[model samples]
Target: MIAGISVAVAVLAGCGPLPELDGDPTAGKDGGAKSDSETGRGVNPLDNPDGTGPGLKVISSDKDRAKARDLIDKVATKGRGAKTGYDRDEFGYAWADSVDDVPWGRNGCDTRNDLLKRDGRDIKYRSGSNCVIASMTLYDPYTGKTIDWTKSKASEVQIDHVMPLSYDWQMGASRWSESKRKQIANDPLNLIPVDGSTNGSKSDSGPATWLPPRRDIRCSYAVRFAQVALKYDLPVTSADKAAMLEQCA
Candidate 1:
């Protein structure tokens, strides 16, 4: 579960061994993207429909917020259900790339490294393997902190699920197919690499109960939650939907 970054215990859920890659990891991939700080401030969700784009940038414009609200309004809502029969394993072995219909799925690298490459710049890989990211400079949207993180202290940077799985279960995902669970679990659109401590604090919370500490990033965060909900045809709680709408308003 290298794709499975945790706030506590510092271990991926069901993490598998790192894969070995030939030649340069970025060589001839992603339109000849450089190894430097290539993804400037990230991409706005409104323009990044497929989520092949890197990073989650803030939604600042009035027009974008208007569009965000419109997008959010499409989300269905109901009161949350009981959290019975919920488990991490329900999401398909935590970030297994063997799953399909996802952006970076079966791309030879795991979901976690794919996201690290997508969001982090000034990247470095494990000694000989181009697939394992050893270190990178991450611009954490949640806390507005730039972390120069190394795999030696892998827990320092965590991949957060914008709409947490537990929250999803309480909403309606408990009944979804196993593949759908894995899709949401590893989808880049629903993932963000942020300060580990901040991610730890946000464990399984929705917009109503928790949001990014950085106020400016909240609207974008809200829009992302809505995007995930609508894309999966999942419903959010009514209170959660209200809080999400408030951030953009």
Candidate 2:
């Protein structure tokens, strides 16, 4: 029941150039198989309009940065609302696979696994189940490092909602239907796999308060934040929008 297309497998084949490493544990191993930046990792947000690809690639060109800024400019801005009635449950159970109207909905795999499969390279599935990811090599765009991940050490890698759920709640999702809320929550366009600690630190903060620690990826991250806001007809706090623009500036 996994919906949409199967997770892109090019990552396993090392689709693109390897990212430069500085003390990356997975670096220099197996001739840098683990460091491969392929499989759409580091994809420009402009090229990846739907967000079903791998990691956020750095937007380095002047033209691309201008494009990123243009996208960020289109995102409407307002003050974030109070979190008066927000709750995780308001968007359906975390990672529920049965939610309707999202890319991977009813796909027989939970959101977490779908994302893990989407972003991880050399992915291994549990015995007799393609839906459960046993292990994989993940290039964490947030930190610009590669991770050799296994289910047993699950916290080492965590799925990040590029537009966090609580932030969404404050930014107009509070008035959305249950189904629409669920769609935004599960949408691949809004998710990425990154270091667990980094994800934790982001904790509901928008671009103004937090961003990926890796400076090179900031422009791409800003584009992603704006993309999600535009897709859902949500507005960011003026401060958040300004911070997003600064990343590309």
For all candidates in order, the CA lDDT equals 0.79, 0.80
| Candidate 2 TM-score over all chains jointly | 0.85
Estimate, for each residue in 6-113, the C-alpha lDDT of model 1 and write its tens digit: 212222211322222112223334678433334334788788876667767778789999999999999998888899999999998876888798898998889889
lDDT of 2 by residue, 1-249 (tens): 011212221121112332332233333345663342543255677888887777787788999999989999999988888999999999999999988877888988999999998888899999999799999988777766567889999999998999999999998899999999999889999999887876887889888778776666778899999999999999999988898999899
| Runs of candidate 1 exceeding 4 Å displacement | 1-39
Cα displacement (angstroms), candidate 1, residue 130, comes to 1.5
TM-score of every prediction relative to native? 0.84, 0.85
How many residue pairs of model 1 clash at the backbone?
A: 3
